[model samples]
Target: MASFKDFNLSRKVQDAINDMGFEEPSPIQASCIPLVLEGKEVIGQAQTGTGKTAAFGVPIVERAGTDRRVQALVLTPTRELAIQVAGEFRKIAKHKRVRSLPIYGGQSIVHQIRALQQGVQIVIGTPGRVLDHIRRGTLKLNSVQMVVLDEADEMLDMGFIEDIESILKETPDDRQTLLFSATFPSEVRRLSARYMKKPEHVTVNRGEMTVPLTDQVYYKVLERSKLESLCRIVDSEEVSLGIIFCRTKRGVDELVEALLARGYLVDGLHGDLSQAQRDRVMKRFRTSDIELLVATDVAARGIDVDNVTHVINYDLPQDPESYVHRIGRTGRAGKKGLAISLATPREFKLLKQIERETGAKMEAREVPSLADVAERQAEVWRNRIIEAIQGGSLGHFRAILGNVIDEYDPVDVACAALKIASAGELEKREEEDYNFGDTGAKPGMVRFFINVGRNANISPSDLVRTISEEAGVPGQTIGKIDIFDRFTFVEVEQESAPFVYEALRKSRINGSRVNLEPAKPRARR
Candidate 1:
């Protein structure tokens, strides 16, 4: 319950904390910040999303002098984490004018060298890149008074233990070393024994890897039906902001494409993306421009956005630690969150392993049915109508209703007005119940074949735009889309299929003549 004000920090540091809207110190921050400020070598054992960044960052920023001689060095396991930690340092040091730079791979080292020449007080980087800089004589650690090993266990798992040792050797022996890891494996202990000078150990929330504020659930789904199940849950739950974790870059891309094809506002993040691309995606996600982000486990490291309402595991992680990290993205800062996992029958063992490791029971949830989705949508519509009525802005509409009532039965007039107001919702519900044919499409939708596909370099967004603009079909009404090598299959509402088909039949996509027709049913085996 202690506040950052009680830390005896300098005026500039306190001002920065206040400006960042931090009224209190998390448990890790409360315990470690004071020790760090006192130049104590402290070992912090805490999971992700526990505000450990500020615990180390605040003191690093405060202790670093204005001379800007790279006095503090932070080593992370991944480039994303390096960038994230450096960003935190920069934010906390804004008023104090302490400079922190992130050095990592996939970036121009020449640019980093130029920045180093300009002077920087704090350098946050991955161990590999940091070692490269030291070998090149570009990063001088002789003046470094403090060193931090964030996510030390992850660094070990990534085979950076040797590099970390080398980096530690270059720094001054009198430097304070702070090591933080979610789990205290033997390797971390060895590292601390070799480098840390009697570091004080602090552990918080070690028993439960998963946060209590998050509602955890898992669904038993077939591999092929996972995408359909994901869509159903997202639609039924009305997830505003969420992160979907995939097992690989290819999975992330495929899921992102699937979600985009369904007209969901989403993007993908993986190791293949450039730093600039990653930055742009994160910026948009943070600003709520993107509703959902599909990311691989390695790519999502150090992502600390707080507004996420849900964390979905599209693919069960290979290990329990990854599972914890994926779900930890949500339920942050005491906000309630939802974590869902889609698992195939074969993957159920992995789910059980995660449960055993985390010691948290995941409630089993069924895939939402079409009726369930309709009910959820109706509830949302009803709430909106109630709010509008409560706001007293419907007076003009009431007068018109009264005029109509004078000519017809009041009940009939009310029903007609309700129908007009709820037309879109009603149409959606009716479409969900409509069957397309023997193509095995989802109810309420019909599948259509389009000539343009991946070979034409057409993306899901392009297809959605073409259908919406040329075919006059609303984007939301479009369902799943599968683009093959030479053609694409798209699902549209049963009622809108004809309009979309006819509109695109005579049109051109990417300057090529387009062909559109209902998809042929496949022969059953």
Candidate 2:
């Protein structure tokens, strides 16, 4: 429960913590930071997403002098994790003038050697790569003051025991060691006992990590229509905030792109992003500026944001740890949360394994129908109208309603207003018709005129993003758009025109007010 300030860290480390938006220390950090800061050997037992990185990172960065001798070494199991840990060091050590580099395979070892030659205070790398550097004499651990064995269990599981031992022997025996793992199997414990000097044991939420309050479920989806089905579920469930997990970096990218094009506020996290890019994306996600995030498992480590109403597995987890860690993101602090996964028929075996691993049954669900989505939206719209009425600015609309009530039955008028509010979705038929009369439009597209085009310095992307963002329609469905000096003519598909029209009418482009309507032809001219 202690704040970051309670650690009595240097001003630079404190500022860097603030820069990373650490409003407070997490349980792992709270338990481990002080002990690590005291330069004592420590062992931490914590799950992923428990802020373990910063627990060790803050002390390492704070204590690491500006000397360029690689004073700290962190060993991770994968190149992805090495990069991610290095990124966290860069952020935490931002104001401390401590430089860290991630040396891993597949990347240019020559570049890593050059960076190391230039003198970095910290080195984070996979065991294979670190050992390679040591054997090549590119990395010298004589001056390494602290060593971190992150995810020790995973490293041993991957058969890195010999490499880990060789790498550890290269460091000075007096160096402080910090070992962290989700579970301490006998091998991990033995490794710790041999290397660490009377380490203090620190465990958080050891046995009770299951998310009992979370409702676990899965939907059977066709491979081709997975995105469509996900959108339907999103519309029907009305998630306050959600994180969708994909198995690979590419999967995260593709899913994020698809969701954004469908007018969702979304972003992606993967190893492909630079530290700064990842920071920006995460900052936005934390502030709720982006409501939905798509992320790979590694990139989502240490994410402890609250009020995450949903955890969606766009791709199934391959392991028990990944499966449990993903769903545990929601259903925190006694708030009810839901975890859903999309599964093709071939993936049922994987799903059953997850059920057995987590000791929780995943309810099977069918992909929500379009009608179901519409009904959910209408109910949300009615609730919004109720809120507006309670918040009292509704008197302004009362006069407009009064005028309509004079010519029609009050019930009919109210129903008409509700239809308008819902963009006529309630009355949608198999054909899904919208009567955009007398407008100059192609057979399947409606052309609309927009005020302030080139004159307002607007671009087609701006228009597309705005229309799609405001109207909740797919950006890909928008047709051609022509820009003029003072106005623009844009084409939209017939069904989405009304919603797009209404959304734009109340918005602005390039600080200029928007006035949008169906375009008319000048036939006589």
Candidate 3:
């Protein structure tokens, strides 16, 4: 289809899509949206990050109404994906009167029950949690009209196939079913064959299995200091014509502005830009006028640049396919390239998920120290001076640099002059929060000591709920939690450490006042 208009979707959904800045449909979205909207069972073979969520989400939201009796049920393999899928439904149904809820393990069943009682139009959850809710009689699937098995292969791998079968049997036999998976093993095929009714099969294969010429790695850093880390890396590496990916349009614009302020030649691309505007940015980027392009995933598609030396993930991608697509922007035309991702400790699970899905091992590295940055900066400057000398005549700057060139290599003189001009701004961010002192957590994680555990009549769910609700962060970001008789130790990503600390400290939990602080690493055994 040429445009989203070809789908003939309702005005509200189309508007929401427009607001999302998506000018075109992804291959999966284009193929499955129409059939799913027609109320047909579909077996869509595609990788994640192909906008499959919207393909199904938009149609589901359009088909369901304000009845609020769970018209649609989406089964996922993990709590993280449940939250993510549910969030997508909420976003797509923002213009409608639909209500969606995500129920999964590590949460309060009582709370989920209460939400269900209040009337939910859509339910998204893991198989185990869904079956639990079903057996407990707190959830009713009799009224469900559409059932979606997202990441079918993942659910099978996690050994949730039995739970999935149990939950599916509870739904009405006539309901529309949609199954999406990256691969179709015999087990998945059998599952679909039994559940779906003459399903239409659509497979969208990925482009050349992850290019062999790319070197993929990630750096762990605190969120607040991420910008500074990016600058240091930029100065430290030879990024000739690169692309830095952000998860959202706002992120793209922010990073573009930040880098531009730091004297980097960069430009931004996102859905918000007009076609003319996007064309101009691409023109500049291809012509090498812009050293870096800060872009969102949706806006960076169909971009084939051969000399992009680096592709930086300013924010971790939502799935592995996005990681592959972003990194593929570099390492084209037989040239070697680097793919770097800036990850927070809280995002360990997602990083692992990507690695599992793509079979790409990303080496975790620490952010460069100032000394390292300085050393790299000198080398980069020397190369720039040499390139300039080889490409142009000396008449342009000989008069100004002639005296210094007499005693020093022209490269050294140029480097010293540029350093003085910039005043080392790229290496500086004095107020940036850089560390979580001795939290005994993993390399990129922070361990917290909380006062109030079992003795305080608290459950891990309560702590998760309090921290997630009070701090206004997603509950999934809360990492491995340990509860004790009178205290607890919770590990959070380093980026969320300070927020979780300030938001939960001195707050009341189960009517008992609480104390929370970073804990020192325990003595090694």
Off by over 4 Å in 3: 1-208, 383-447, 455-484, 489-516, 519-525
Residue-wise lDDT of candidate 3 within 430-510, one digit each (tens)? 445646688777877889998778989888898888777665457877888999898899988876676676666667788
Residue-level lDDT for 506 in candidate 1? 65
Higher-ranked by lDDT: 1 or 2: 1
Q: Supply the global lDDT for candidate 3.
A: 0.82
Residue 402, candidate 3: Cα error in Å is 7.7
- After TM-score superposition, the amount by which residue 285's alpha carbon in candidate 2 deviates from its true location, in angstroms, is 12
Indicate the TM-score of model 1: 0.72
State the lDDT of candidate 1 residue by residue for 342-453, as single tens digits.
8765566678778887887999887888678778877887787789878887778877777677888987876566678875544443323323465546877788888778
Off by over 4 Å in 2: 206-231, 238-310, 314-320, 328-338, 341-370, 377-525
After superposition, which runs of candidate 1 have C-alpha atoms over 4 Å from their true positions? Answer: 207-209, 382-525
Worst 10 residues of 2 by lDDT: 425-434
In model 1, the Cα lDDT at residue 300 comes to 87
Candidate ranking under TM-score, highest first, comes to 1, 2, 3
